[model samples]
Target chain A: MPRENPLAPVERELRVAPRHRLDLVNEVDADVLALQAELERRGYGPAEARRAAVARLVPGGRVIRQLEDRHRPLLGRRVLASGWMDRAVAVGAGAAAAFAGVVAVVATASPGGAGMTAAIRWLLVFVAALMAANLGRAAARLWVQGDLRQEERQLLWARQTGLIVAAVAAGALGAAWEGYPVPGTSVGAGGPAFVPQSAVWEAIGSVAGVAVVGLAVAVFGLFGWLLVTPRLITDEECERRIDDFFAQSRPRLTPDSTKAQSHAQ
Target chain B: MQVTLSKRINELLVLAVLDQGPAHGYQIALAVEEQTGGSFSFQHGTLYPILHRLEADGRLRAEWHGTGRRRKTYEITGAGRAELAAGAAELEVQFRALLGLLRGCHAA
Candidate 1:
């Protein structure tokens, strides 16, 4: 007699079972299809709709929660009441930047102002330090939330590290520009004429400085925009987004299929 | 106008849909949307959890059926029907009260 197939019994049981829980694979596929259809109905092209559908299904993490929370205080609140604090902060930052710019210009215009130059240098360092501290605090909060997976945590750490490194590089370039030595040219003369090597370092340092300033300006603009923009999502919308994320991210398995597969193995 | 459904109202909506007969998730969603004149769109995340919760509470029964790919369908229980009736009554009372207030405002 031929050896009996061990998989036969499990397959039989699966066939006999009247009801089974919906497995994750089918669940995700159905949800994605539904989302895609909905998005397409809203005038998104097929590709764009699919991409959006996938993004909606991504698993929830600390980063996502943080982003969602950033919008929460504005939701369902009176516009004036919800935004006053952020508007105040943005106005204060703009004033500080304007004051710093004026001070730097005045210090540069002063005659034989070695001291003023030193103060300018200190100001740059102070700004860099402030940026670093703020970035670190934000990163720390994200970490403390502890909802991130290992990969997400690593990605966040890598991004923060890159920003810190860039800030340090910018600060160093600024300092180098301030102290760049003059190169001596031997013109037939009473003394060697020293030309300040500020041109090259100044260009490089200015680029870095502009980049940092632009980032700060962009952040301030974002804050202002957030303060002004009406709330985009209701509580139901938020809950829906969160649910889609989890539904997409979590693993799905059916018991009977697993048993059947295992028996076949 | 878009009507925002509270959690209880959403639950009642699901129960009312199932009261017609057994229906799969997608079908139920379609039914609700159609009944509301496309004003109500239920996301999978919102709908599935509610269905599972109802099943867990013995207010609904879920069974999988299909040949190639299984689909989970739900049927309303007696408890679910009772809850639906109570919710509809409550909603009717509140809606009438609001309507009366609006009429009073118009009179004033």
Candidate 2:
């Protein structure tokens, strides 16, 4: 036979709610049990105090409804609400802008290159266009989604977005100036260029090689950063964020207080 | 008769009460009601969610203090105290501003 739960009726009622959390039910069990004991200690009969405790705590199924609103799986809401998501988006855009920097460098450095360079220049150029498209894409999201928890954080998000845009603009101009096409000169002729014309494929290979190295460095840096920094926000922060969801998640004026105030008046 | 408090005020009050000393759910709620001179009260049902949420946030630390129907007692953490201090200051400012506005209205 199972041990008797003194707050069985209260527990049973809370449990009856659809998809109710057991942890909450148990806590309520302890609360009501304690309240009943306190009432008994204050001179109420055992049975009367038990009945009163249940009535006081679980009034009209309100708590169960409030719990449903406040404590349901909050990962989706947190992903939207936590300021870090916007930060991550800003960081991503910044990295793409940095890659755009490489694009400007390659474009101005493309003329009169060594052999085998043009062979891979096209691929790097493709990636450069892709970054430009991504910068625009990221910028669009920033305009529509500035919903952070605090005004200060929202301002930070704006600043980060601004920095990303600045980087992109500067990177494009610099790379274009540096990698300008040679004037009136074919691959075999002297022209307005930097490195002397030779193996186009080899220059392309060199750019790709540099890109590979940069990508490897970024991956390792991100991994190391993750290893060192502890995640600041936990599920608890979500509970705080959704304050309005559980509109009645609050304490109340007890019957005793009202009587005390009324008697004094 | 029960008067439900706003969550922010309730949280602030809870933290303030716990700052005095450690207590379990029932004792904390009772203390708040008694100390407020019947101005505030907490239902067992309504308070558990807040307590659990606070515990999760590291604002309050809980430990089962006794055996055989032993209750889970809560102590205010450093974070809880910091929040309480901030909240108290904000509330005081708001009340002062409110009082000033009301007095000006009466004068008018």
Candidate 3:
């Protein structure tokens, strides 16, 4: 014979109320009964197991705050690790994409010259801009999520602002200098002469480009390095350190003779 | 006797319970309470978050089962089992130190 549903009446009643705490309580009670049975099977005495099951019968709201507080530190560590891993992966993928772009530029430049150079320059600018935007977003997210004090947050913001201002000034200066005429280049009677620019300006542009790329590389490399370095202090070690710190601060009783000597002094 | 649940110990307990076989959230909580002889009480809200975190860490696999009232069932992975063993060892060391501290306090 098919077993009758014990909760049929409760379900019907729930249909009328729809969103009631009483329905939640009933569901929790059922779960507690199931837990009690499992506890008995594991060799806990019936009364003791029932007590444990009953403890969970309280409304979830009352206990959630305590649970979150207890687990916050552990959760924080996990979040930090996850964020670092994400940054490392993003950096790795970005580097690979940049390398592919360079290869494509080389292949395309072989067929055409002036037009290709201009296209490549624009492509480079686009890639650099995209990379900067991505880094900015990542840094902002990290700062927002971080459990930093007010002063630390202000310091970080200032440093980031300085970095942005410096980068913009350098880029603007480089762009302006890039359009300067070559030292020997002059206009011919028929048309303009195509003389290669001064080695000095070319060298400066090369240095500027290298500096920008190097900065990006350095930032990504730091994150990648952190990802690979084995953790010096595991959770267990941290716990032990905390315990030891407390133990050291705990008051100790001196010997009676020592106490007397101190009192006499 | 009521005992505060250590996050590390609670994780091991969850993994250990699932090691027996695949089980749902309520069942895991039951097994943990029973095994600890009611000393450790874990609420549904507390257990679910830990389960979700363990799943994210790839220590456990979760799948929704049942109809109408869908239930989430969990199973331990190899990584979880390895972690349980490591946690047990670490707990042993912690307990030993704690016992010594308690004994010294009593003597003093």
State the lDDT of candidate 2 residue by residue for A1-265, as single tens digits. Answer: 4434433434344322112233343345456666766776688887787676766564346765455435433532354456566765576677667766666465437453333343334434444545344333433332223112234334433543444444344334333332433332344375535454554454444444444433433343333333322221321243243322233222322333332222222
Per-candidate clash tally: 0, 25, 0
Q: Give the TM-score of candidate 1.
A: 0.34
For residue A194, model 1's alpha carbon misses the true position, in angstroms, by: 98
TM-score of chain A of each: 0.26, 0.27, 0.27
Residue B6 in candidate 3 has what lDDT? 80
lDDT of 2 by residue, B8-107 (tens): 7888888989999887676777788889998988764677667767887899998863332234678999999998998899888988999999999999
Positional deviation of residue B89's Cα in model 1 after best superposition, in angstroms: 1.3
CAPRI accuracy category, model 3: incorrect
Model 1 chain A: worst 10 consecutive residues (lDDT sum): A13-22
Using TM-score as the yardstick, the better of models 2 and 3 is 2
Q: Write the per-residue lDDT of candidate 3 for residues A1-265, one digit (tens) a residue.
A: 4432222222222211112222233344344555556556568777676666555543354343433332344434465546764765576567656754763454334322234334434444454444444444434333323222234435544544554444454444443443343333345333566445565656455445534443443344344324322221232243344334333322112113332222222
The estimated TM-scores of all candidates read 0.34, 0.43, 0.35
**Highest DockQ among the candidates is held by which one?**
2
TM-score (chain B) of candidate 3: 0.87
Which is the leading candidate under TM-score? 2
Residue-level lDDT tens digits of model 1 in A1-265:
4432222222122211011111433443444455556556668887786655544432223322322332223321233345564664465466555645754554344332354334544454344444444433333222222122234434544544454455444445544544443232223334757444665555445444534443543353344334322222232243344344434433222123332222222
Ranking by TM-score: 2, 3, 1
